[model samples]
Target chain A: MKRKTDVAGEAQSEGGLAFHPLDQFQVQPLFGHGPIEWYTITNVTLWLALAAVAIIFVFVVGSSARKMIPTRLQSVGEVAYSFVHNMVEDVAGHDGAKYFPLIMTLFVFILFANMLGLLPGSFTPTTHIAVTAVLGFGVFLFVTLLGLYKHGLHFLGLFWMSDAPLVLRPIIAVIEVISYFVRPVSHSIRLAGNIMAGHAVMKVFAAFAPMILISGIGVLVTPVSILAITAIYALEVLVAFIQAYVFTILTCVYLKDALHPGH
Target chain B: MTTTTTTTEAAAEVAHETAKAGMPQLDFSTFPNQIFWLVVTLLVIYFVLSRIALPRIGGVLAQRAGAITSDLSAAEELKQKAIAAEKAYNDALVKARAEAAKIVAEAKTGIQQDLAVATAKADAEIAAKSAESEKAISEIRAGAVEAVKEVAQNTAKELVAALGGSDDAKAVAAAVSARLKG
Candidate 1:
């Protein structure tokens, strides 16, 4: 970090373009400055709570009316409800539908967190691997345990494709087993990487937004950078929703494997 | 949000005293905090959703679907009733038209019967009056013929007296009768 700061300072001296794109991702204390303990109420806590509140706003208050003829707010709740509902049913199949609330929690929580993080100067909980790993591995652990409990040793048949030639079956099983274990890692990283990259790039552009204050060349750089920022922000909104959706659907896919490992 | 300045100087100094640190996500010092809060958030979200929100929203959706279905059936029933009413109205209209035609036919038959009787009575009266007129004409002819006969007989007698012959009324009458007969 010190080296990064020195490099940024040198860039500032050279072209007046000092910016820390990754700085936005730093977890900080929301209230007071100190060493962060396990129970410390940091920005992650505040934002996580905000995400929960947003979930409540969309799920609880949005559906508080329960109107037969739904108002706009109720429609929002219903849309989110049906969207996740259909995704679960579609990907996880009928037997996996009982786990809908679990999937909904993940989708809504991640969705709200990602969206709120898009606000300027706000922290994104999902951008942290620690947070996403909890989500990804939570699904992973649940699915593995459920599979092992339900099918016992038969669950291992998921990796052993019997239809393959005897010569290739062992090789295929090894690959399948390894890939199966890698699901949570890829799942968590895919989301965090997409969000972090988009945000970091936006920060990079935003850092250039003040170029007009520095040099005459900023007349060109400032508007272009602002446009880039706008474009990336728009894309981030889409990415935020898509990542949540991706996470939820992947959870469903994994849930399907747990329920019926034969496929 | 705290920048790298505060993050690098203190948090990293306390937890991870690595000579070189790169990304904040990689900073293991904050992992415990993030993991702790994430667990809490997920737990809260899961409980709230499963207990309250999911069931409530699901119930409302199911209820709305039920309402729409029932409303459709009711609309279909009402349409069926409207169709039945129109059919009934058409049937009544047909019956009324038939009744009116029957009444018009009955009134026409009654008027025709009366006209037939009146025409027959007028014909009979005219026949009777014409027979009476014919009888009067026949009587006048008969009387005129008798008067002409008498006048002829009186002239015959006068003609005979002028010829200085005797007046034989019976012979003259007989001769006139014979001449008339011939």
Candidate 2:
């Protein structure tokens, strides 16, 4: 006795459409089997790949032409190289040279992936929570292992309230542990959610233009949609670069804490 | 009639309620499924690109930079050689001009000496000719006087011989010789 739309289509929530635009983030299992769960092929993946190739190509080619009198290409490459190199040195300290390769790689990969998602018809891989989570988890795992290896069980001092008053130690320790556990989740979700929300909203707004134009009821709607898309797109571009920087910088900070759990 | 109207109204209300109910719910779980595969795909890409493709590209870039530096150095050497050659050529040109000026000055000195000798010889010849002309004029006058004396003596001798008087001719010749000596 259900109507046609009810039987085959998405059920409209009393709140609105059954699928809030954000509902796309819900992680549903594909076949309900295997260690390798399936997810939708969103545009995020496409962007990440684009970003990776672009960054690699630009920097590699730019630096490849090493001249005593450097060309514009070489300068740009050196700037990126020096920036990341300095970041590692500052956070990881003088001994950070060892981690240069890893930090540099992370910066480049994240930056390129983020930028790649900005292009039309492309997906950003970093926009997926799974992908970001894996990356964050890897960093966490690496730094934690490094800390434990270097300091033995004393690395646990990173999470303990060692310097706090005796009475307040337990309370601070609980907070510290919880914060430590939230590291990967926050790192991954912060990036993926920000990018996904921006793109989804942009897509929804874009969908409105055609609807308004075809309906022919309002002239202002089309222009408004266009302006909104432009503004959001611009913002997304900034977000892409910032997020990459933040991710790499945070990784450096985590490494610093692992290497020296002083504070 | 009133009951019938009420029954129709009730049926209409039921239809409106069904219409307002909208569509059924979708299995909202599909999104996570999509995200999971996306991770796998991304991982595979990262491994293949980072491990394989990126290294090759990096190698090419390194080679290209080396090539550029070498080319620049080679060009610099060539430029230096050209500058050296230019300097050498200018020096040679200056030296050649100096040598040429020296030869011209030497030739001028030789010509001046020849001119001085020729002028002196011409002046000496001119003086000698003027002296010789003066001697020729003097000799012509003396020869004229001697011829006149001889003529006179021959006539006097012819008259004396005709008269048979050799003493008269000797006296006349002695008088003429004394006058010529004086």
Candidate 3:
């Protein structure tokens, strides 16, 4: 109770009346007051480490028993494994199974990070464009390199849709090339944008929670804000899982393009 | 009011400084650290999954599949045994019924044979009794014929004596005997 009042006082002292909802996304050095150096450990690092540890706990330690009948935690691990496994296989075909581990790693990492962010005061590493951009660019680079290696110069054929009119072939090829390069941008933005928007909205609704102290209309607005927060929180949970799925399946789709570079 | 305004100005400066820091995600300074950790964490997870977790989980799944297949095969074997047992039971039952019918038929024939022998023996005894009764009846008829001859001879002699005719014993005997013979 004392901590709550102190935090409220701090917020008031810091111009709480003009609270910026996006302030929650600010990254700062976890240690002594100083500019964040490249080597400085931040909240992003802490939460990301926690997310990785959570994934390892569920997958590695939970399945250490390797029981023929899975425990609850092991079942969760297996479901995640099979879910990504099927995605890679179904979308990218048997050739995609080879990359299942890579795709699975991305999925578990992002999934845990997203879900962990739902905890109050926890940082969401996935909401950052930097992290998502890394993943997207990594996938883009991997697929592009794989396609080039496998098909050599023939890989360029993917850009040319032979079904189109020969007169329009060059134009279509240009469009395809542009879209192809745009994959990483859209991929990173989609996940980071969705996660950031959901978190920001939640924070906005939470900011209105202080309206309850306004006396006259506080009582009515308080419940409505609380309900909105609850609703958005629920939606964010769905968004977290959906964004992870969307990212993984899209990776598989790009892998398919690499594997089969034809129309 | 002046002190309050100064405090407000100070707060605005702080807020401005915070805003100047901008979105941490956009902060170019933090990228290397976040990316570094991301690579490190991803590499760690990848190693764990690829080296340890996935293979173990896959082994469990494979073992489960093997167990199911073995169980199904065992069930199939047991079903075959059951079918064979049922067939053997049916065969034994048929054999038992046939044996019972054979025994019944044999028993019936033996009884009929004994009955025929008894009937034949009874018929032989009846035939013998009728033969002896007929012989005795013939003997009694012969005796009655001899008595009747003797009487008839006596009557003849009396008749003769009353009429006052010769009454010689040897003549009378000879005449009587010759008339009887005739």
Q: Which of candidates 1 and 3 is the stronger one according to lDDT?
A: 1
Measured by TM-score, how close is model 1 to the native structure? Answer: 0.88
Listed per candidate, the RMSD to the true structure in angstroms reads: 4.8, 10.9, 6.7
Candidate 3 residue-wise lDDT, B44-83, digit = tens: 9899899998888878877888999999999999999999
**Can you write out model 2's per-residue Cα lDDT over B129-165, one digit (the tens) per residue?**
9889889978987888889788767776777778887
Model 3: residues with Cα > 4 Å off, grouped in runs: A1-18, B1-22, B126-182
| Top model number, lDDT | 1
lDDT of 1: 0.90
Better of 1 and 2 by DockQ: 1
lDDT of 1 at A34: 92
**Tens digit of lDDT per residue, candidate 3, span A1-263?**
34435655866874444445666778777887687776788887789889978988999999988888889998998888888888999999998899998999989988999999999989899988989999999999999999999999888999989899999999999999999999999999999999999998888778778776655566887799899999999999999999999999999999999999997
Candidates in order have lDDT scores of: 0.90, 0.69, 0.87
For each candidate in turn, the TM-score is: 0.88, 0.57, 0.81
Quote model 2's TM-score. Answer: 0.57
> Candidate 1 on A1-263: residue-level lDDT in tens?
56756776777684777677887888888788898899999999999999999888888898898888888888988899899999889988988889999999999998999999999999998999998998998899999999999999999999999889999999999999999999999999999999999999999898888989989989999999999999999999999999999999999999999999996
For A4-109, candidate 2 gives per-residue lDDT tens digits of: 3563254333213223343333332234433323434434333444555576567655556555555786666666666877898898777765776677677777
Quality of model 3 by C-alpha lDDT: 0.87
How big a share of the true inter-chain contacts is recovered in candidate 1?
0.80
DockQ of candidate 3 (2 decimals) = 0.34
Candidate ranking under DockQ, highest first, comes to: 1, 3, 2
